[model samples]
Target: MPVTDVTTDPEALTMTLVAEFAAPPERVWQAFTHPRELARFWGPPGWPATFTEFDLSVGGRVAYYMTSPKGERAPGAWEFLAIEQPHRFEVLDSFTDERGDPVEGLPSMRTTYEFTAVDGGTRMTNVTYFASNEALEQIVAMGAVEGSTMAMNQLDLVLEGLREYAQGKGTQTELLSDTHVRITRLIEGPRELVWRAHTDPELMKKWMLGPDGWRMSICEVDPTAGGQYRFEWEPVGDTEGEAFGFDGETVLVDPPRRMVTTEHMTGTDYPSTMNDLSLVEEHGVTLVTVLIEYPDRDTRDAVLATGMTEGMEASFARLEREVMG
Candidate 1:
């Protein structure tokens, strides 16, 4: 759906904006409540916001600063006046000094944020109130309308990212132990669709590439327990025989639920890994957890340090589009 409006009424001393996001209400709420998530898209296109303090309860204060590319900074704060979980909240928004304290003699605004769950996503309505028409005009002259529209556009991107995450398009990597590294994602789609993506060769080829130009060239899956599988990859324009690939032996298999395998990369000096893939269905979403056991802590750390997580996230994002589409 389109934005309803972003209008400022100087007579009423109010400024309001409206937008919709392709995410659930709770997901949209988290984008506001979670500090790290809020920082991702809380400002205009160039000036990005960084939060030093974020507390969502009533009477709590949130402090942040927006840093421009030319090294300028604008500090601000929001004192939460009321909160109603995933539905609504009200805050007193103000200008702040470098120390995160409100600046004296500066006008502040009271803002109410209302979130409504819609059929396909969430509708966000924001209303800001100033003490006087002059105060509203002052901020309006500061490009509040344009800046907020840009910020909300960024929020649209953030909500799209969150939607993918909610559909299992995001990846989480952590050290389960000194030798075990766990990577997990809650993927949207049915269990069989997820299973096919894992086991079917053609579907695997669709999303198994690391970057844009790379390709998963050879995929073979003999999906039973004790079966063997191989996946080979190369740059799209590769002319040489050199290719990066992996082979594995399935140790256990349970359709749409669990699969255990030993993964051995063919061209790497790194240690082979044992992966336990578990898929559980809850509310029509499949939670896919992959626990990978490296030979030692050093090997696991080395893998992590390679910055492979970004590639995994990119790959999974494509996977969601391929499967869910």
Candidate 2:
């Protein structure tokens, strides 16, 4: 497979990959829309794979299990949001259990794949949404960006293999920006508990917020559009830090459904950070997504360089422990 263009803007944590495959739109579409075909190239290489339940309709689900080389098996699921044969398919992807249950405190992302017909082939593009800029960075640090690129490349290989088996000429594969991080996780807990962990200041302090030295002076939420919120984090360590504060203006706040906030730090003159949270309930479990958008590439790169990814993963792990207990 040949990649025509692969562009990655680490600041926006966005990646665009453009590739032309030798097959027509229908063939490419079948490879993606069909669950059996998808499982062949969906995960990292050398992982044992199995599909549990596959329903291709809107609101339907596709669940599968993958066992690593060490014999550790993990289950994952995807909820179909939209499916247009031979053109586009959108789904919410996450890691789940054998019974199709979501785990706790992990982010679930929205993934959309589009197929277009070219002169003699098909063009495919994949767009993924993360919960927060921090979450995206964390996934990048964990190598999701590279893993996904590899997965896509493997998809190209699968296409070529299919062509070979069918006695057709093999084509190619490509990438646009390969910088974006693919974030997906399973959160296992009741909706109300997860809601409390998010909105209740005391509870949030226990998990979402950092420890004693970096305490939050104020954490108030109106839970409505045009509502106001202020969160201040002060450092206590001996090391000279950025020595700044954090603030955000709420743009959209719909309780237990979704919330969007524009965040600004004290030193950074620009209100460059956008935070988005979404919550859903499945079989009594609550799944949440937190998306953070930065002002530009520089700020995004700076934050990534500061080990923010590990910090976020720790915070989320704390939240899971607190809630699951």
Candidate 3:
């Protein structure tokens, strides 16, 4: 559910996808570069993937294939051009024949993968460049956009499993008072990065999402005091026209330090709430504290009963990765 945006620019000859995972850079990196993990999520839903070769070093080459439900196999290869551990890498990917050779006259793309450590997780931005605008259009017309989106969605699920196996921990929440609830975690990055990720809409879109099959369709943020922000979540799948949205006004803002906002969720019966977010750095990590205060005890209890904490925890976990890289 961490895939926030997928876009194509024929004029720029590029296809870009921005996603975040609730796992550290190292863990996310391994999921991407390791053959076993890559095979688990490289294909879209209903397609099984198999990786015959995977080498992460510069000049390395990888071969893989995805078997469709009808048993048809589509093969591909990656010619790695550059690599930086737990951060970024570049590769030239292309379709391959049965012999593992690039198909003649087929369009190939040079992909750049950037991994950033944000709060406690990692944000991955993938940009694929074609040799020409025509080549970009060709692939876009061939359903690359839809296929890649589904594939990345699978990666989000894969990351959750990987984190559970490696960390053996789930998100924790605390009820501090009758009207206040708090969620705190030590994000694996500097305070500044966490601050920017929270305040900037571009960064926020990389991770903030609604429930499964739903995404933030609208995001507008003005981070200064007295400024306002808005977010709208709409079902991206077959939800039969269901949508929800929210907006907020910034009461106060201090870079890398503190922020106070008054938020309202539309189409909901609960009253507006006040949110206080504070960030502090210890060693090289950032400790993020979020306190939510409802208008009254009943309102707080009503909101809690709606299962908001689970979504909030997932959002924060993804936010952690958005800032770390």
Model 1: worst 10 consecutive residues (lDDT sum)? 160-169
TM-score of every prediction relative to native: 0.51, 0.47, 0.50
Q: What is the C-alpha lDDT of each candidate?
A: 0.79, 0.63, 0.77
Clashes within 3 Å, all models in order: 3, 24, 13
**Top-scoring candidate (lDDT):** 1
Per-residue lDDT of 154 in model 1: 55
* lDDT by residue for model 2 (28-56), tens: 88887777667766765434356878898
How far in Å is the alpha carbon of 322 misplaced in model 2? 62
Expressed as tens digits, the lDDT of each residue in 95-142 for candidate 1 is 999987788877988999999999888899999999998888888889
Which ranges of candidate 3 are over 4 A from the true structure?
162-325
| lDDT ranking, high to low | 1, 3, 2
Candidate 1 residue 207 Cα shift, in angstroms, is 22
Q: TM-score of predicted model 2?
A: 0.47
Looking at model 2, residue 123 earns an lDDT score of 87
